[model samples]
Target: MLESLKVLDELRLNFSQSGLFILNLTLAFIMFGVALEIKFEHFKKVILNPVSTLVGVFSQFFLLPLITFLIAILLRHYITPTIALGMILVASCPGGNISNFMSSLARGNVALSVSLTAIATLSAIFMTPLNFSLWGGLFTEIYSRTDASGLVRPLEIDVGQMFQTVFILLGIPLVLGMWFNHRFPDLTKKIVVPIKRLSIVFFMGMVVMAFMNNFDYFKAHIKYIFLLVFIHNAVALTTGYSIASLFRRNATDRKTISIETGIQNSGLGLVLLFNPKIFPPDLAIGGMAFITAWWGIWHILSGLGIAGLWGRKRKRVVTIQ
Candidate 1:
C-alpha cells in the first residue's frame, strides 16, 4: 500500500502548451463570471454589517490555514508529506466561484456570500502565496525528519510571478466583468448565466478528461485521497460555521460562511501546481495532483448536497409552522 501510494509521487501527468493555455483561459472565464455577479452595492452592504463579513474572512483565511496545519500535524504519521501539503494549499485558497449560488440555494445571505467571495479572492492574491509558502515550509521540515522519501517540492515561491499571474487571471477579468455588468445590466444578466454554465462545463470536462486519461492509475490509488479530502473539507465547513456561531450570526449568515469556507478554489490550486514555473511536474505528481484534482470535483458535489439538505430542512420547518 505504501509503495503504491508512493508511485503517485513520481507519476507525472502529460500537460501540453495548448492545454495550459486552455486551462488558463477557462479559469479566467470562470473568474469573470463570478465577477459579473458582484456589485458595488454588495461591498457597501458587507461594510454595513462588518461583523459577519469579518468573521467569515477570519474563518476562511486565518482559521482555515491554522486548522489545516493542525490536521497535517495529526496526519503526518499516516499520510505522505506531499498529500498533507496539498490539503494546506487548498485550505489557503479562496472560496470557490459558485459559493454565492450555493449560499442562495441554501437560503443563506447571497449578497454576503458574494461579498466574501470578492474579499477572499482579492486577499488570496497575496495571502495564498504567503500561506502556502509558510505552511508548506513547516510541513517540509516536519516531514524531512519523519520520512526519507520526500513527497513534496522545495517550498520556494516567486512572489512577484505569482502576483503577476493572479493580477492577470483574477484581477483583470474581475475588473472587466464588473465594468461590463455595470455598463449593460440587461445584457450582463442574460449572458452571465450562459457564461457561468459554459465555463463550468468546460472547466470540469477538461479536468475529468485529464484525470480519466490515466484512469487505471488514479482508480487504483484514489481511496486514500478521497478520504483525506473528505476530512479536510469537513474541517473547513465546520470552522466557518463554528466561527459564525460564536459571533452570534444569523442562520443565513452561518450557512453562507460555511459554504464559502468549505468550497475552495482547487481550480486555482491545480493551475498553480501545474505551472512549470511554480511546482515542477515531478514535484506536483502524486499527492498534490490527486488531492487538488479530486477536490475540484468533490467540493461541488458536497456543497450542493449540503445546500440541498439545508433547503429541505428549512422548507420542512416552514411547512410545520
Candidate 2:
C-alpha cells in the first residue's frame, strides 16, 4: 500500500488538451446551474441571520483547511507530501456543485445552503489559492524537518493567475446565471432541472473520460486511495457539524453546514491539476490527481447517503411530533 501510494508521486495522469477544455466547460456550466438556485432572498436571509452563514463559511474556508493541515501533520510519515497537498487543495476548495441540493434533500436550510454556496464560491476565488499555497507550503516544512534531501516540492499557487481563472470560471457565470434567474424567473424554472441533471451527467462523463485516458493507473490505485479520502471527508463533515453545534445552531442548520463543508469542489481541483499553468501531468502531481478524482466520486456517494438518512430521519421526527 505504501509503495502504491509512493508511486503516485511519479505517475502522472495524462489529461489531453481537448479533455481539459471539456472539463473546464463542464465545471463552469455546473457552477452556472448552482447559481440558478440562488436568489436575493437567500442572501437577504443570510444577512439577517448571519450566524449560520458565517459558521458555514468559517468551517469551509478556514477551519476545513486548518483541520486538513493537522491531519496532514498527523499522517506525514504515512502518506506522500503530494497526496497530503492534494488533500489540502480539496479542503481549500468551496462547497461542491451539489451541496445546495443535498441541503434541501436533508430537510435543512436550503436558503442558507445557497447563500453559503454563493459566498463560498466567490470567496474561493481568493481563499482556495491562498489556503492551498499556505497549507501546502507547510507540508514542505514538515518534511524538510526530517529529510536531509528536502526534495518534496511545495505547491506554489500563483494567486493572480488563479484569481483570473476562478473569476472567469465561477464568478462571471454565476453573475450571469443569477441575472438570468432574476430577469426571467419562468425561463429559469423551465430549464433549471434539466440543466442540473445535465451538469451531473457532464461531470460523470468527465470522470469516465479521465479514467479512460489513464485506465491502468486509476483501476490499480483507486482502492489504495479510498480510505484516505474517506477520513479526510469525514473530518470536513465533522468540523462543520461540530462548530455549528457549538454555536447552538439547530439541527437543520447543522445538517446544512456539515454537508456544505464536507462536499468540496474537487472538480475545480481536477481542473487545476490538468491545467498546464498549474500542476499539469509532467509535474507528476499524481497523488493530487488521484485524490481529486476519487474524492469527486466518493463524496457524491457519501453526500447522497447522508442526505437520504437525514431525509428519512426528519420524516420520522415530524411524524413523532
Q: What is the TM-score of each candidate against the true structure?
A: 0.95, 0.96
The C-alpha lDDT values of all candidates are 0.84, 0.86
Task: List, residue by residue over 1-321, the lDDT tens digit for candidate 2.
Answer: 767888777876766788788988999999999899888788788778899999999999999999999998888778887888899989988999988889889999888899999899889888988898788887778777876656444655556777677778889888988999999999999999999889878888877876675678777887779999999998888899999999999999999999999999898888877787766345768788789888998999999999889999999999999
Candidate 2: C-alpha lDDT = 0.86
Please report how far candidate 1 places residue 179 from its true position, in Å.
Answer: 0.7
In candidate 2, which residue ranges exceed 4 Å CA deviation? Answer: none
How much does candidate 2 score in TM-score? Answer: 0.96
What is candidate 1's CA lDDT for residue 249?
A: 98
Q: List, residue by residue over 1-321, the lDDT tens digit for candidate 1.
A: 456666776677757878777778888889999999888888898778799999999999999998999998887777777777889989988999888889988999988999999888788888888888888888888778777765434566665676677777788888888899899999999998898788779769767756766778888888877888899998899999999999999999999999999999888887777677776554545677788889888899999999999989999999999
